[model samples]
Target chain A: MTQSVAMTINGRRREDHVEPRLLLVHYLREVAGLTGTHIACDTSQCGACTVLIDGEAVKSCSVFTVQANGRQVTTIEGLAEDGVLHPVQQAFWNEHGLQCGFCTPGFIMAAAYLLKQNPSPTDEEIERGLEGNLCRCTGYENIRKAVRSASQAMNGTAAEPSAQLVGSAAAPVED
Target chain B: MITAPFEYARPGSVDETQSLLNKYGSDAKVIAGGQSLIPLMRLRLSQPTALIDIQGIPGLNEVRRDNGSVEIGALVRHVDIQRNAMLRESLPILVEMSNDVGDNQVRNLGTIGGVIAHGDAAGDYNAAALMLDAEIITNKRRHQARDFYRDIFTTALEHDEVVTAVRFPVSTGRFAYTKFRRRLYDWAIAGVAVQETGSSWRVGYVNLATTPRRGSAVEAALAGGASAADAAAQSGSDIDPTSDVRATAEYKRHLTQVLTVRTLQKATMAA
Candidate 1:
């Protein structure tokens, strides 16, 4: 059976007819065409489908679209405003957080919510906060660094950019 | 992946939910937070014809102290339980167990009632509840912790029965829970929860069998004034755990002893 549900996604109010069995991940990826939320595992073990609901991070795959009626959802695409990447996104890019990039968006979204709740998370806190997310490519060393860097960046300390720290200058050499 | 087609009802009250359950009978499934049931539905492990969404039900999401026990509403999410000061002070074991369940996202969306009612042997809440001697309160009746589980994925819940709350005695003693899992948020290969009530200690084992069960022999030995190591040796005397992809029964038995010793030491330190 299909039911009409209304929700606010990425700052826009949306109303649609959805099947009672449609998962929120499918609704976000297909119906809403916000494909940044990826489904890495059918089981709830993988955190690849993480999204922000009412400013708290949750696994979209585990939720039904009907249950999200009148709720606020923030996807990866909604992180940036006015062409500027959110601090966590920028940190991930600068810290070399992603090698394959499949898990970056979910990690970024989860970290963004974590930082909101805990601005100065210890290494152990970061480990526990991001325990739901799994990344096979980078082995999580870079991801942890990225989260710490993002936490600093969000606090506006203005540390050295990731590219310069890694000895890769963006400007072309004059010959 | 698509879930099987099903009728859905968002009941506003417990009476409405009970009536829906009575109407649908065996064909209906009660969903609190949809943390566990939704995954099962999508996997076709459970194909209920109708879903009675109880998320909006009143009086089912509270955590309050009543009659010297902590009454946790069935719909109380794990996140709420972890943060509840009363629960933290009264039953810190539950708070510790909640912190280790799945992860932050799962804890935010998962409900205590859903976890216990699902009756997965590997579930951390089951072990914690069993160790604390929690009462599983339902719409029809209340079941004691020892009598709650029938087998893996099976409980004492009647066809139309709905769990409204769980009640655990406020503990002044120390308690600790230790789970060994391959990865964070994964089900335990084997885990142990040890609680010291006054001078007596009780131990509960998880993932050591088809249902969470107490290490009665260890508890007996402890009550008999046995040393922690001596009591830990009897950890697997009451369980017949299966060898699965996670670990061998022998390995789990060994982990039972190891975890029991460690947990008891931790509980003692807390005491």
Candidate 2:
């Protein structure tokens, strides 16, 4: 009942002997220890378990681990690189897009996939694109703002990051 | 919840797949996109002893146009169908209908063959396929779309038969599909599809019955020169729908008429 599956996760190759019944969501969270991909509804109704399978977003909860054998999977944990956040993640942080933070990873992953498909989407297009990923805490206005900001950031219009020395005497006080 | 334990095999060829099917018989289920099957399995509605994954089979995912028809391979995903340039130019109704399927995530993995074989009554592609007079090509033989469905979630597919592709004749006339649902991603409570077949219109209703229902009375009224409103009013005359949790039989019937009128008007304007 167990099958050997070989897949590249978040850019690294992984091999696991998983049950044929093991869902991709569980596989990503448990075996790979990529707990960033949350499983809120276990069911496919919620996009909390969304991930990029071969660069296309799909519901990992609905996909079996065996079905993803020899494929590439990118989880939410894979979004940041070299201690820097992905543009989508940075947008979410800068715009105060998330209230609960439970749905942020899934939303960021979904937004990443959406912006890839549409670089400069209209307001209606952004609504239709992220309709699959639900945010119960935030009424989606801030999430929509984050997605638009991320789109602008990814298009190279945003200002570059500035490096500032820490612990300086003139440093601003923390909130 | 996890799926029931099952043996898994990914056959690389159609013949190999058929042999596995013949060996496992009805205890085995063929999984293409696994969009519908995986959900049912997780819900325990289906617990097959063996799952034959056909997604690895080669050459079953291509969309080619031949003669006067467009031949779509069984593994053609909904997103591919919607984005296919050839299909968009030759038959855009299929693309339009594909756009209304499950959300972007679902469409990325859900395939035409998977949807057709699952044959849910409320499925968006069922009535569209029926209206287009599509032909389902299986490894064993070909099946007309009209003869494909037997009942709710049932199809004419044999245990060992594998659906290879579907052939749809190129349609040059107008077509429109309207699906009524409570939410954006929910399945249709009732749907109306209008496709011009030669000199007459073919109207098909979804979720109005246990099987895909042809609005024969509506089509006939239209052929007799009745207005769209009158023809749409006749939509409830030809089909038998049940009162399910989704809607009352009366409500479904009412939706059928109203959606039929809206769909007919859209199709007519396109024509």
Candidate 3:
């Protein structure tokens, strides 16, 4: 009743025997032990379970594990390189985009895909792009600011390191 | 909620997929994007004994123009249709419809063929295919979009047939698709699509009935030079709206006319 699946998650090859009905989110959380991809909503309505499948942001909860065979998945844990943070993750810290931080990982991953699609999204475009994810804490203003700041950082227009130093996340932030 | 256990197979060719379908018959479900099917399976709303995963099938994901038709492969995902430069140029309204489908995550995994095959009334592309006079091409034959729907979540597709592609005639006129949703991303409570094909007009209604309904009377009135508001008033001629959790029956009819007028006005403005 189980299917063998081979996929690359966060740059590591993983092979597992999973049920045909086992969702990718369950496999990522229970089997792979990468729990950063939260399941805020089991239904695909919320993007809290979003991850990159072959560089496209998709709701992991809706995707079956066997469907991801031979594909590369990038979760929230994959955002950092060695000891440095991804620009979007750094921007979240700089902008204080989280309160309880439960939805932060999903927001960062969704924003990463947003920036990849539109590196310099306008304020309105950012809202439209991230409509899939919801932050129940009403931290949308900070989330929007974080995404905008991430766009600047990724596009190399971020404020000087002194301003970035104000953030708790340390610098030489890039790998 | 977890889905009931089922046997799964990924077939690489349409012929092989058809064979699997023949074996499984009504017990097997062909899964492409799995956006709708997976959700249904998880809720146990539908429990098929077998699943023929057709994602591995090749050649059903390309969008091309051939012999006066814009042929979109069935496996073409919504996001790709929304972003396809060729489609954006030749069949822009289809692209616009895809943009309004669901959230980005849903669009990433949902395929056009799956949506057309699933045949949800509230789905945007259903109305688009009808309004644009697209053809639903299957492994066996071609079907006019006008005769595609049977009822709610029902279509003209046979149990063993697979939708290989949809061919749309190149649009030569302006269009406006107006839909009203309760939430920012909810399914359309009521929607109206008006397309002016240069020589004639086509109007299709969404969620106004058991299936995607064509505003034939409204189109007729418009062709006879009726004003947009007057033509939109004819939208309710054939549709007997039903009350659902989204809106009251009267409210849905009201929205149909209101959105019809809005879409017609928008299309006129574009003209």
Write the residue-wise lDDT of candidate 3 on B1-271 in tens digits.
Answer: 8999888889989999999999987889999989999989989999998899999888999999977789999999989998899888788778878887878888899999998999988788888888777899998999999899888899999989999999998875788887688655668888888788876789988878888888889999999989888988888884767998878999888788888888888887986
Q: TM-score for chain A of every candidate model?
A: 0.90, 0.89, 0.93
Clashing pairs in 2: none
The total of clashing pairs for model 1 equals 0
Q: List native contact recovery per candidate, as a fraction of 1.
A: 0.83, 0.83, 0.73
Chain B of candidate 2 vs. true chain B, TM? 0.97
Q: Model 2, B193-235: lDDT tens per residue?
A: 8888789998888888888878889989999999999998888
Shift of residue B91 alpha carbon in model 1, Å: 0.5
How does candidate 2 fare on TM-score?
0.95
Candidate 3 segments exceeding 4 Å error: A162-175
Measured over the true interface residues after superposition, the C-alpha RMSD of each candidate is: 1.0, 0.9, 0.9
Mind giving the per-residue lDDT tens digits that candidate 1 earns over B110-215?
Answer: 9999988899888888877787789999988989988999988999998788899999888757888898898888888888888778778778888888999888
Model 3 superposed RMSD (Cα): 2.2
Best by TM-score: 3
Which prediction has more favorable DockQ, 1 or 3? 3
What stretches of model 2 exceed 4 Å from their correct place?
A159-175
Q: Over the stretch A4-102, how does candidate 1's per-residue lDDT look in tens digits?
A: 999999999999998889999999999999999999986877799999888888999999998888799999989877656777877777778888888
Best by lDDT: 3
For each candidate in turn, the TM-score is 0.94, 0.95, 0.96
Q: Interface RMSD for candidate number 3? A: 0.9
Please tell me which model should have the higher lDDT, number 1 or number 3: 3
Per-residue lDDT of B131 in model 1: 73
